[model samples]
Target: MPNKPSLTTPPANDPSLDNLGHPAIPFPSSANPPVQTEPVVEKTAEIMQPASEKLTALRAQAGSKLRSETDQAIRKLGAHSEKLYVSQAKLLDNCHSQLRKQPMIFLGLAVATAVAVSVLLHRQMR
Candidate 1:
């Protein structure tokens, strides 16, 4: 059996490969000065703090707006319901006044309605 060439090793004298036969990527060595991380962390915190505050303020503003709108809607509904109640009371008062003015007429009408309903029920049973 013949030996197969490995896929992991690059070909010799390849232009893309460095003298060490590794890809030509620059890596940090002891020669370069160490990168300072504290400034980056402070800058990130400085950038995020205002954004967090703005988000919290916006949330509170939206909640306040929603509460105010809900209260306004409830007040409007309550006012409409109050109007409906007043109108219903007025209608009942008018009906009572009419019945008082003509008790005998309403009584006759009631008896006729009762007789008509009984006749309908009796016919349905048959």
Candidate 2:
């Protein structure tokens, strides 16, 4: 044998080197202590985030639907109010026409009563 090397010293130099002059990363330790937390905690947070976002979207949709329904109801009420006004005006107009058409009937009744009273007074004087 050529000669056995001393155990105290490391190898003469590393085999791999980069142009930037930094050493590569070494392998991670496999025999480290177990993590304190369960893996489910991280997974639950990932699952919950998307669900909350979807819930907010649904709430916005419902609010918009409610507003649309309320607007329609208001429009219907306004249409009914206009209809009521037109009906009242028609009723008043009909009453006025009836009074104008019967003016001659009223005058004839008044003249007949006055003539009857005059004749009765002349007979009594005789």
Candidate 3:
């Protein structure tokens, strides 16, 4: 008779596939830490304990990471605000310098307008 093709289970002696058909071996169980092996009956509790501990550690790390991110963002905002303030101060300084350089022009225009108004007021009074 010819060998029949199998679908679910591999041949018992097949070197490639385990009984469960999962690539020769199953994934490692957390219960049997590489350091020591637990009895089959104690595997479930051993696996659960490690998973919970890892989760707690991850949570603490996540909190610390979030706090660090917030602090960095605040520092960046403060730096940008300081830069904006400095820019405004520089602009105002430039305006004051230009006004100082052209003082004569402004003074002349002010005196002329004042003199003309005074003359008109005197004529009106008379």
Best by lDDT: 1
TM-score of each candidate structure, all chains considered together: 0.59, 0.43, 0.41
Report, for every candidate in turn, its global Cα lDDT versus the true structure: 0.88, 0.78, 0.83
In order of lDDT, best first, we have 1, 3, 2
Per-residue lDDT tens digits for candidate 3, residues 84-110, read 999999999997997899998878988
TM-score of model 2 (CA atoms): 0.43
Q: Whose lDDT is higher: candidate 1's or candidate 2's? A: 1
Maximum-TM-score candidate: 1
Model 3 RMSD in Å is: 15.1
By the lDDT metric, which is better: model 1 or model 3?
A: 1
Off by more than 4 A, model 3: 1-46, 103-126
* Candidate 2 C-alpha lDDT tens digits along 25-68: 43323653445566778888888999989999999999999999
Model 1 Cα shift for residue 82 (angstroms): 2.1
